[model samples]
Target chain A: MVSILGVGLGVAALLVVQTVMNGFGEEHRLRIRESFGDCVVIAKSPIEGPDVLIARLKADPEVISASAYTEGPALARRGAFSGVAFVRGTDPLATDQPVRQYVVAGSFDGLDDGRVILGIGLARTLRVAVGDKIEVWSPVMAEQAEKGKAPLPASLEVCAIVRTGFTEVDDRAAIIPLRRFRELWSLGERAHGVTLRLKDPANAVATAARLNVGKAGLNFIPWQEIKKNFLEAIRFEKTMLFFLMFIITLVASFSIGSTLFSAVIRRTREVGVLVALGAQRWHLVGLFGVQGLLIGALGTALGFLLTWGILYFREGILDLINSLFGNGDMVANVYQFSKVPLHYDAMDFVVAAAFTLIVTTVAGLVPALWAAGRKPSEAMRDA
Target chain B: MPKVVLQATGLKKSFASPNGPLAVLRAVDLVVHAGESISIRGSSGSGKTTLLQLLGGLETPEGGEVFINQVEQGLVTPRKLLGHGVGFVFQNYQLMPELTALENVVLAAKIIGRSQVEGKARELLQLVGLGDRLRHLPSQLSGGECQRVAIARALINEPAVILADEPTGNLDETTGKEVMKLLLEVVAQRQTALVLVTHSREFAEKASRRLVLAGGVLSSA
Candidate 1:
C-alpha cells in the first residue's frame, strides 16, 4: 500500500511537472501572439515608403491596424548618464496595441512632437523620465551627417513612461515618431517597416499571402514564423520531459512486476489447484493481470482526483494566502495577474491517465507468466 | 466394464540436469476407464508424479501422445483439453488464497462453460461440507478445509475425468481419510474417472485398480 502511494506520487509529480512546462511555453506563445499581431511587415527600403504602404493596408477590411515604425540601435544620453538603447519610432495614435497599455506617465500624444516614450528600465538607466531632455545619437546618422558636414542634432525630450514586464523589450528600447526617425536617419520618403494588426491572427498566412509583392523588395513574415525557433525548442523540450517522466511510472511498474512474481511463487500450490480444476494458462495470467489493473486504476484515479481537487481550490488557497498577507495586490506582482492562471485541458488529463494505465499493465507480465508456466504436479509436489 | 477415458503409449519425459538428461518418464503406457478409481503408487523419484502428469495431459511427453475422452491430447492443445474435460486437484490444496471458496469453485465452473455457476459452486461446497465457508478465503481455512475447497473446485466443472496428485498429502491421517472419502463420493456422484497418485498404501489399496510405477513403467499388482 505504501508502495502504491509512492508510485502514485511519482506519477502525479511527473504529470504536474509536464503540465507546468506546457503551461510556461503556452504562456509565452500567448503573450507574443497577444503582444504583436500575427505578423509584422518589415521593409528593407526607406521608412517613408513603408509608411505610405501602411496607409493602403489600413484601408483593407482584413487589416485591423497598420502602423509605421522606425527602429534603430543607438545611444541615449542625459548629462554624464549614457546607456546603449534600441529606439522604436511608431505613430502613437495608430500603434496603441495592448502591449503599450502600460504607459505610466505623461501623454502618448507627445509622440507627434519631438518627445519620445521611454521604457521604465531605460528611463531608470538614463536617470530621466517624462519631461526630461535627452540626446538621441545613432552612429549611422552621425556618420551620414559627417559626410555632409554640420551634423543634424535631434535633441528629444522624454514624455511618456511605459512599463512592459518583458525584460528584452522594456529594458532596452524607446519609442519615437515615424517622421522624426526618418529625419534622424537622413532617409527620404521611406519608413523602416509597417506592423500590421490583422482582424484574426489565425488568418496571418492568408494576410501575408495577400501582401506578397513578387518584386516589391520587402518581406512580410508572420510573428509566429519569426519566433518559430523558440516555439520548436519548447516543443522538443516537452517531448523529452514526457518520456523522462514516463520512466518514473516505468520504475513503479517494476514494483508491480516484483510483487506479482512473489505472489506467483508463494501461490504455486494454489495455481496447481486451479490448473487441476480446469483453469487455462491464459485465464490464470488474466486473473493476476486483472489484479494489477485494479491497483493501477485505483491509484491513478485517486491521484488524478486529488490533483484536480487541489487545482479546483487553488484559487481559493491563493486568496487565503493573499488575505493572510494583507495585500490584495500581492499575486499581481508575483504572477503578473490578480488570480492564479490555471488552464485545465481535458486532453491533458486523458493522455496522462491512459499513459499510467499502460505502464501498470506492462508491470504485471513477469509474474503472470511465472504462474502460468507451473505444472500442476510439479507445484503440487512442493506442497 | 468401463470405457477407457485416458490412454498413453510409450510416453517419455526427461529433464536437463548438470549430470545428464534425467529421464522422469520412460516408454510408459497407462489406461484409465470412466467411473473407475485408479491409484498409482511409487517411491519418491520413481516417476509416479511424472506418470500422473503424462496421463493427465498436464505436461507434454517427450516422445508419445496422451488421449483424454477420445480426443487426442496432442491434437487438442493442453490448455484447451484441460479447460474442457480435465479436472485436476493438487495435493497441496492448491486453492487461490485471494479468492473466496465460492469464487474458487465458480472459477472452475466458469472455465468449462457450465450453467448455474452460483448454484453449482454452492452445491460443490456443500458436498465438501464447506457450504458455510463459501466466502472464506483459502488463507482463512485450515489444511483440511482448504483441501475441501480444492475438491469443490475440481467437481464444479463436472469434468469427464478427475486427477488428484495426492489429494490428502498435506492433511493429518484422519483428515486425509475424510478428504479421500469426500473426493471418492464426489467423483462417484459425477460419474467421472478418478486417478489418484500417492505413496500411501492405504490410498493405493482403496482404488478399484492399483498400479505401482517404478523403473519408468506401471504394472498392476
Candidate 2:
C-alpha cells in the first residue's frame, strides 16, 4: 500500500500538471488565432488591387476567409484624456466573424456606419464611456498641421471595447471603418496587409511554407511566428516540469528497491536452505526477480488507475474545491479563464505508464541480481 | 568395499582473518559407505562446520576435492552436489519463514522434479511426529518442530548421505535427544549414509565409527 501510494501520487501529479499546462497553452493559442487569424500575408509595398488578392487568397480550399486591413499610428484624445493607439482600419461591413468574436462589449453592427471600437485597456486610459466621441490625430497629417495647413482631424463615437486578455493588443489598439479611414487620411484603396483564416489553425505553418509570397512582393507570416517566444517558453517549461516531477517517481521507486533488498537480507537463511536442497543460482535469481516484478506491477497498476480516476473527475473535483472555498475566483483571478480547463491526451497517459513501469522494473532487477550472485555458504555460516 | 557414497580427499580450507590467513582444515580425508553412520567430534571453532561445508560442496576446499558415488565434484555447484546425492541439515533449522511445515518439507522434492511427491513429504513429516503441524509456518512452530521439518526436507530427495551439522545444537537437551533419535531411526530405516558433526559424547557414541577432529586432523576417538 505504501508503494502504491508512492507511484500513484507521482502519476497523478504529472497528469494533472500536464493537463493544466496544456489547457493554458490551448487557451492562449485559440485567443491569438481568433484575434489575428491563422495566418497573415503582408506586402513589402502597398499592392494596387487588394480586393483581387483577397479573392484569390480565399479561393484556396484551406483558406476559410480573407480580409484586407489598414493600420497606422494615431494620437488619440478624449476630452482631457490622451494616449497613443494604433488605429486599425478594417472593413467592418464585411461580416468578418474571426475578428468580431473577440469583441468584449458593444457591436460592429453600427461601427462601419458611424462608430469606432477601442481596446478595453485603451478605453480605460482614454476615460471615454461607450457611445462617447474620441478625436484621433494622425502623425503623418500632424506635420502638415505644424506648417500652417488645415489638418485632417478625425472624430468617431465608441461602438465596442475588445478585451482580448492579450495585454499587447488590449493596451494600445483601436478599430474604425475603412471608409472613414480613407476619408480622414486621404488614402485611396491602400491596405497594409491581409489576414487569412484557415480551416485548421494548426496548419498555418505548413500553408505559409507552400505560399509563394515573394512573387507578390508579400511576406507570409504564420500565427506561430507571431507568438513563437511565448509558446516555446511553455513548451520548454512543460519539458522541464516532466523531468522535475519525475523525481518524485524516482524517489518512490527507490523505496521499492530498498524494501526488496531488505527482504533479500531477511530471507538469507531460507535461500541457503533452498540452495542446499539443490536449487540452482538461476532458481534464486528467478525467485527474487519474480517477487520484485509482482510488487512493481502492483504499484504501477494502482498508480495508473488512481491517475485516471483523478483526471476523469477533475472538473467536478475543482467545483467541489471551489464550493469549499466559497468562490469561483480560482479560474478567473489566477488563470484568467472562465472555468478550470483540463486536456486529457491519451499519449500523455501512455508516456506516464511506460516511464513508471520501466523505472520500477529496473529498480527491482538490481537487488535481485545481487541476491542471485551471493554464495549459499554465506547464509549457512550466518545461520 | 560396500560402495562408498561420500569421499573427501586431502581437503584444505582457510579463512582470511584480520591478523593473517587462518587454516581451518589441513589435508583431511574420509569415506562413508552406503547406509553407514560416521561421527566427527570437534571443540569450538575447531573447523567441524568448515569440513562439513567442504564435503557438501557448499564451499570449495583450498586444496583437493570431494566425490559422491565416485563422481568428482568439479566446479561444485548446488545442482551437481545435490544431483550426486548429498543433503544438508543446518544447525539453525533453516526453514523458510513464509512457508508452512509441509511446503518446507516439499521444497527439495519440488526442486528435484518430483513435485507430485507431496504425499511422500507428508509421510516423512508424519514420521518425524509433525503430522498436525504440517500447516504451521516456521515462525509458529517450536524449535524442535522446525528441526523435524528440516529432517523431513532432507530425506524428501532420498539422498544417499545426510550431512547433519549440529542438527540438535540449538535445541534443549530433551528436545535434542528426541530429534537425534528420530534422525537415526529414519536414516537407518531408509538405509541412507549419515555423517553427523556434534559436540555431545553420548550423541557421538551412537555412530558406528567415531572420530575426533583435533588440531586440524581427524583421529580415532
Best by lDDT: 2
- Candidate 1 has an fnat equal to 0.67
Model 2 steric clash pairs? none
lDDT of 1 at A198: 79
What DockQ score does model 2 reach against the true complex?
A: 0.58
| Per-residue C-alpha lDDT of model 2 across residues B80-174, encoded as one tens digit per residue | 76633887888888777888999988877887667687899899999999999999999999999999999998998888789999999999999
Question: lDDT, candidate 2, residue A39?
Answer: 86
Model 2: which docking level applies?
medium
Model 1, residue B202: distance off in Å is 3.1
Score chain B of each candidate by TM-score: 0.92, 0.93
- Stretches of candidate 2 above 4 Å error? A93-96, A99-102, A107-110, A143-147, A213-215, A309-331, A380-383, B70-79, B82-84, B111-114
TM-score of 1: 0.82
Q: Please give the CA lDDT of all the candidate structures.
A: 0.75, 0.81
Candidate 1 backbone overlaps, count: 10
Question: Per-residue lDDT of B123-165 in model 1, one digit per residue for the tens?
Answer: 8789889979988998899999998888777777666678788
Q: Model 2's lDDT to the true fold?
A: 0.81
